[model samples]
Target: MNEELNARLLELLARIEPLLPPEQAPIDWSRDVAAIWQRHALGGRLTAVAPRDGVRVEELVGIDHQKQALLDNTRAFLRGRPANHALLWGARGTGKSSLIRALLNDLGDEGLRLIQVDRHDLVGLPTLVQSLRGSDYRFVVYCDDLSFEGSDDAYKALKSVLDGTLTGPPDNVLLYATSNRRHLLPERMADNSDTRIEGGEIHHGDAVEEKISLSDRFGLWLSFYPFDQSTYLAACRHWVAHLGGRFDTDAEAAARRFALERGVRSGRAAWQFAISWVGRQ
Candidate 1:
């Protein structure tokens, strides 16, 4: 009876053992600890250093300086050097976010990772840092379409992550963000400033200035403006030529006509028009 009872107890314990928290290295005072842990869900997110196993971020168009600036930064990080947090700001659909991914794909090492933290997840910034603090891989915490508006408290968490008084972000980590608004707000208006004075609200102006300062925290700021008439036409020509005689007419005229009809001249608009033209065949 005693032997039978011991076997049953061992079987029960084995079933529950796998559910317990993983064992850590023997906690030793002499050992310098970095709290970095592998992100189990990284492959699922399509954000983190993408499992280069097979991910495709669309190729970015037209922004030459923007592309090189980003590539340079990522290269430095991969080489284990200091790199600045970046803010990619400007007109909508300028491929700010796409460029970030492409740069990572082009330069990131197995040791470096891209962890996308959504705007809604801003409150968890510190938690992310704590989790990543000890890891050897460099991290690019990416935020897309990030901005603060209408009493949003998430910015407070972000400000801390950007340049916290308690502790700077780990050398192994950096941040990259994309925003449509230069100030990331609604014309720099304040909740109470509108009621106080119309011509000049001193307090509101200061508040706007503060919001702008958050963007300034970025060491590298890359602005993507609307593409020009020639650039737009060039993009069309590039696409058409790349396709090798897809269109019979000269691309310059059609590109101009497309931009005029769309009422916008941007890299994204250029690509959209090009894709549409290609599909016509």
Candidate 2:
């Protein structure tokens, strides 16, 4: 009995004082936070890819309706009016990004700053907001080509950034996004299969419908369709004349050649064709 008792006591001591397997030093959360805080401009100091002067809004040329719609929203934002979060959706290369950049130049001097965060960086938005929560200047958090492709988690983070569940979008911040997908998803035909829970009844109070409902978050939805020949030629003529390029490239003839070459027509094509034709200069 004594021997058994002694062995058990030894075992307990060994287990209790096993050197703690070389304890890992506690993580310094404050230091970690400070490090992150330093590297990221939580105060909303913007770092645009191309500085403002390079982006000339007055020179965007054409798409008067599209330009006017966006400029109006931007002006509203500048005035602290009840402005809507905008979603610029449509054909690729149709000045979606250009519009956002142009707005910064047009309004940057009005205490407005455009901070472009890459799509993958959307998850860091909470941290970003927390950092910039107390700033005085207004901000436009621009995301180019934003969409979901098995990236539901990123969307969740963006939902909070767009319209927070608890804090809501910071009064100083507005999100402007450009996407090719109208629904922001691939428009899967299968989504309809589940939106029906009891045969012909739209499924509410469910994840699938909830996900499909994300588009409603944005107040404005603008579409940029491919341009017709006249608009295309006008775009080419505008850019060529403005940039002082070789414009005698037969405006009408060049317009046809641009469409025939690309098999598509849009402001983007017009600009590209103009650049190519100017090589003749």
Best by lDDT: 2
Error of 2 at 186 (Å): 2.3
**Candidate 2 local lDDT, 242-262, one digit each (tens):** 667856647668768878988
lDDT against the true structure, each candidate: 0.69, 0.69
Off by over 4 Å in 1: 1-59, 189-206, 241-250
Candidate 1 lDDT over residue span 176-227, tens digit each: 8899876665553344474465456546556666666787788898998888
| CA error at residue 50 for candidate 2, angstroms | 4.1
The lDDT of model 1 is 0.69
In order of listing, the candidates' clash counts read 6, 0
TM-score of 2: 0.76
What is the Cα-based lDDT of residue 40 in candidate 1? 27
